[model samples]
Target: MKMNLSCCLYLAMAFFSGPATIFALAPENEVTLHPTTWLGENKITAVHLPKGRTRRLYFTLKKKADLMSVTVSPCAVPIEWSLAVRTLKDKPPKKSHWTSKKSMPEVWWKGSGREVKIYTYTGNAVDTYTGPAYAPASIYILRLKSNERDTQVSAYLHEGPGPSGVFPELPPDPRVHTLGVGMTSVTLSWAPSSSVVVEEGQRGNRPYYEYCVLVNPKHNHRSLCAVREGSKKDENEQMRPGKELKKDWWWHQPDTPEDNESSSALWDNFEDPGCVCKDTESVCTVSDLLPDTQYYFDVFVVDKVNGTSVPYTGTFARTHEEARPAVTPLREGQVKWVNLNGDASSQNGERSFRFKPRGWQQNGLLTMHTCNGTGKVKVTVSTKGQELTTQEVGHELAQIWLHGGPSYLIQLQASHSDKSRFCLRMQASSAYHRRAVPVFPAMLQIKSFNRLRTCNSVTIAWMGTEERSLYCVYRRQIPHGSGKHSSTDRCLDPESRPASERVLCKYFQELDPRRAVTTAVISELDPGVLYVFDVYLMRRWGLPIKYHSKTLRTKSEC
Candidate 1:
């Protein structure tokens, strides 16, 4: 019989991405608890040095985290240097303490001078200076000897992005509100985010960070920020050097002494300006709103030094009819699990479950009840053929954080015994459904489809013609045979192939050049199985284009 498989409709919606500013911190990133401000009181200017004598910077290290390197601003001059360490009781490094040899790597091209602490880089630049192997959690002195006495030197001892540095996760601020909802307008205010950036060991803290507030009046497609900058350029063009931009705004680097103020009033100590209840300048106000007009307010935080943090979680406000229900809620639809080896989920049986999410469903879990057997029985749940969760099913119930796709597969494997079977039940809740309109494929398709199976994963590369667009990748395993078993030990073929296997899709948005070639590495795949890849491209203004790959098999793990 000819099997007709229905394709799974994978929603690569922007809703799930939440915010672009929410970036995960890497292992190397650390937070500084007690950092000392650099150039704290010294306002040194660029001048020529007549230096038989040296100007040494003595720094107190706070956090026990060892020094990776010190980053220097105003990197225009060259300084010969050495490092010395002393306890709180010891004096600064004199001629005697600098006898140690070179221990850290030095690259003269960047900024390092003859010695490890000696750095030479050409003005107002940014470079990381080498540090010794062991910088204890005490006071360390940096001695600088420059030929020209008038070298511009502004330095920072960083532990991380600093107190007001880059956020580890996204921002949780600005839990929004629709304030002063009147017939003609409404005000949107979020929790005030601190503009003061703390490079605890850097120069003065800046206080003049801008807020990018986007207001989308309901029943309209146009969107604009209430406080537009003077450039009148695209949101992406603005920059405060070393800062990042998001959907709403971009903060250029804050370099000027005048534009940057002493956030020390708030950073070193708390100094709250008296609250003015009539203030709407900090908040975004969308005027000319129709009565009961619905609107969405999203505020983004831009730091003059570090960059942009995630936008505040958005809020929906309306004029008069101040409430709108457009955000979709995930509904727990029916979940069906089928044993691949037999009708029952016995030991060593591989089963698959299909779920049709009625609305928004993500970061959810499927609770399964199992009979505790001897030894250890491992149960693994896979979504879109990628292992999502794996654990020993020893308790009466086992649950894991399940990332939603089109379908789910639960496989039961026994280590020693194979007599007992497992059972599963549903314990999901229903939420308001926010159905989003479907997006169609565009007109520009990708070509040069190639796949390479390396180690445990497959890497795919392709080229597209669209620019300034987003691309979505979809892939899924083509199950070889039906999980059902015949009277004999052989597995039966599936009754009509599942219309297009449940797609395992991923999204890559705002690609730098949509017209250029792109590549994505897909890992944790079931080795030796044939899989299909589909690349979809959506341009800023044109329709989307879709391309499919030939059946590609990954190298088996021997």
Candidate 2:
């Protein structure tokens, strides 16, 4: 989708209205920081702050902390920048300049060149009007702005003393496995990440964790699996209690605030092929993928509370290739039943059948029944490269409608790599077969009840002497020049309606020998309009047999 100039102007107008407006305009820009990022040392480096643009970062503290600190430093060429800290309850500053004396308390620093500045607060008291402060269960915002020219910078944050108890360790890499592969989807499963228990003497706490599956069409290097650069620290490199341990980003993080603004222009063309699983789920099915192509997957265990993640590498799979359809020949008035059985290992668990509506047979009906099998099957019907319908069935009868057409293709595949068994029966017939002769001259009669007739609808009922047969009802408005009372013994072909006529409704149904009558409601008619309805009995071969016809007019007023 292309955004015109007007759309860009509208977005700009909405962005400057308020923070809420900006968030609503570009929700993907809002990134949730992990608690570890604020409780422990975290460094965001090489962030490009474009001139005249402002960037804001947010973090929330769930528990009380004794100390909070933040540091901002310029990198490479010296540049002018300003930083400010605010809590959720603080109001927006009215002044435009960050260095104004009125903005001093709220603005942590306004510096030029390559100077580094650190802001700190201690204890539970929070100075809402001045300086960076600490408070339990509160959200804080760090706003940064660049002046003069665009430049890069690095920012750091730390809260101490960190949790007195042991910190939760990063989850170990998972063992990935491919359970099944389809033409457009792959099912994967892995062992759940082991729970990390934090112990403080007698009390123990377990942190919740979830999984995120990242998929790339091409292979990714193993080094890319680490969530943070230089995160694989040895025992000697581990930070001691109360000591800051900063982890920097070797590459830009997509979810960072600066990157979000810098990359906003490319959002319209980027597609992310990643999915998140529930905390308890170990199996996930990735779908809507290209067939006959290999894809790499990396699964990560994420700390739900802290938003930290650990990645598992070296997992990939390829989707199955589309199988060629098997053609089946149809004879006039003949019913055919075919059974298909296949295993995923050999057949990829997919089978397709194609049939042409030869002779006068233009209408077709298909019923699929799954036999005793280990997996369910999905059925898709298409023609001329256009898909008509699709459905999944198991151990039940599924009827599919094939509108009048020259040919149609039906594809069936198992949901997974397991033994599949399906029994399908198909029949083709014409709505107006010209060659078939009737066995009974007056076997069917169609009737309409006056009491059931409304201004816009009428009930049609039919009774037939023969059982085990299919019947179709068709309706069309009578042309202006035609007599309202005119009736015909010949049935009009619904597929070949004239320009003056239209097939308002065309549907077929099967009748059992034990049933005496079948009724249908034809609705959505114009007031006082005359319509002709034709009833035909379909045969397995040749043309359909015209059974009965009727003409009715809707009341002019209700």
Candidate 3:
């Protein structure tokens, strides 16, 4: 059967942002020095700095370097660091010197047997540095030297998880913040470090970087699956971790089963599509998540320089099963509707009729209305059943308007099980559109009002009945005899294309707990025009009959 999807697009946009950009170091440039996992203890062994014997770094281009050394110093030791450089290609070997620029130079001793010293270099102008730790011993360094002649630099301290020099800062990492717990896998993202800066006759550096997102079990800390960056979609194969079909994106299974588990496995790794990005855009997908499992994820942004960003983590819990729709009771004085073919009509006291018939949408439409008036009126929202409400329902009716008719069945149910108290009723009308009707008549009321005056403007506000579903405002000219009624074409035409219809002046929505009534204020009305307004609580759209509020007029003063 046909269903309307016109409103679903807006909801989809709020769920997914986009893939994170992978920043690679320049071509042929190395960012990290760790050997593959097979390499034994692939860490730095020693750092030699003999007095008056300068340790020179001979590289083709200026690049940022991260040098770390294991240190054991008193908690009161004052530590200082700086940078130095020498041009091997320049004649006479010209050397430039500069002090390291860092705030809070004193690194605290964390009451440990050994502390690691980390030095960052940003500026490429200098050749060498002379600082407190310049002569430290057993220093292990991970340098990101560049391959180009001219460059820029800055020193940024490493923060968060993972060993230093293995990551770089990016945007998407901080933006996509939800983490699913107990789930097989999760996705993480960070913002890109650089976007192309356009200029005349200058081509910006553009290189595709690799991404390595890892997940470790929270308890034993065993490595799970590691998916590559670019991979094909294969759900069955991704159930467990192994060699992924994608380039850098991979999938991993937890070393141990989750303590509090759900049914399905996690589809954590999503390789972004790049060919579409040649035109400057791309798409990535992550699937196969465990049902009702929670997972923590960390993303690494890698580039050709081997620069990776520190891990950004978040958590989310999957549902055991997809949610199914169910009918909920309506609020007091509110009405709902379900349209069948135009065969039934309201007469005498038998105002309501059952609408559970086959082929309803193709053959006709069902309509339901609720009376929200201050005093009780005959409310007949559903012919099948009815209920009273003091607040709105969490879920409302959904509609799908599409061409090429499809046949479907429509079912109408009561708000409450009480059948004798038929406070609401329904009647079949010639209206083109149909909706859900209420079972009882409503008594509408103006709940509250507010007034404000400022140097530049004046405003009036009002509260609606607690059962209100929709609200609107209107204006009228005060009665004047022999007073000049300037006819400057003040009437606003409500019929333009949907693209230009401004009839809906203001609106607000709350989906978590559907409370019906809302407050609104009108602005920019002329000082001379008498403004009138009203609010309504209708259960369905396009049912013109309303349980409307008492018209309140405002004094025009600005």
User: Of the candidates shown, which would achieve the greatest TM-score relative to the real structure?
Assistant: 2
List the candidate 2 regions with Cα displacement exceeding 4 Å.
1-337, 342-350, 358-362, 365-380, 384-401, 404-406, 412-425, 430-538, 541-558
User: Model 1, range 87-140, lDDT digits (tens) per residue?
Assistant: 332332334212222211111112222223334444222344655434342445
Cα lDDT of model 2 by residue, 1-558, tens digit: 366988898878887787777545544433333221231245333356788786655554436555655545443233443333333333334553332322333332222112123333221111112233444423455555566556555555655544211112333544678899999888888765544332222233332444566566655323221212113322226566766754321122244454344434323222232443444467878787788999887666544443334455448999999766565555544444545555534554656667665455555555445534545667888888899888886653445656656777877766655455545444344334432333332345679988989999998877653435566677777766676666652424344445444333334333443454667788887888888887765545434455556889888889
**Of 2 and 3, the candidate ranking higher by lDDT:** 2
- List the candidate numbers ranked by lDDT, top first: 2, 1, 3
Give the TM-scores of the predictions, in the order they appear. Answer: 0.20, 0.26, 0.22
Count residue pairs with overlapping backbones in model 1.
38
Sorting all predicted structures by TM-score, with the top scorer first, yields: 2, 3, 1
Tens-place lDDT per residue, model 3, 1-558, is: 123464465445544433221122123343323221110121212222233332322111112323322211101111122323221221221221111112101111111123333444432221222222222211223333333221222223322233343223344434334333223433333444332112112543333333334432221111111232113323345645775543322343222233112202213233331111111111122345545544334443333232222223433334345322343333222234322221122222222232222233422233333222111222223322333222221122122221123322222323332223232222222213434332222334444343453222234343333333444443334453535333212111122123221224444444423343445445554444433334333333223233232333345443
Full-model lDDT for every candidate: 0.42, 0.53, 0.29
Model 1 lDDT, residue 339, Cα:
22
Better of 2 and 3 by TM-score: 2
Going through the candidates in order, what is the number of backbone clashes in each?
38, 4, 124
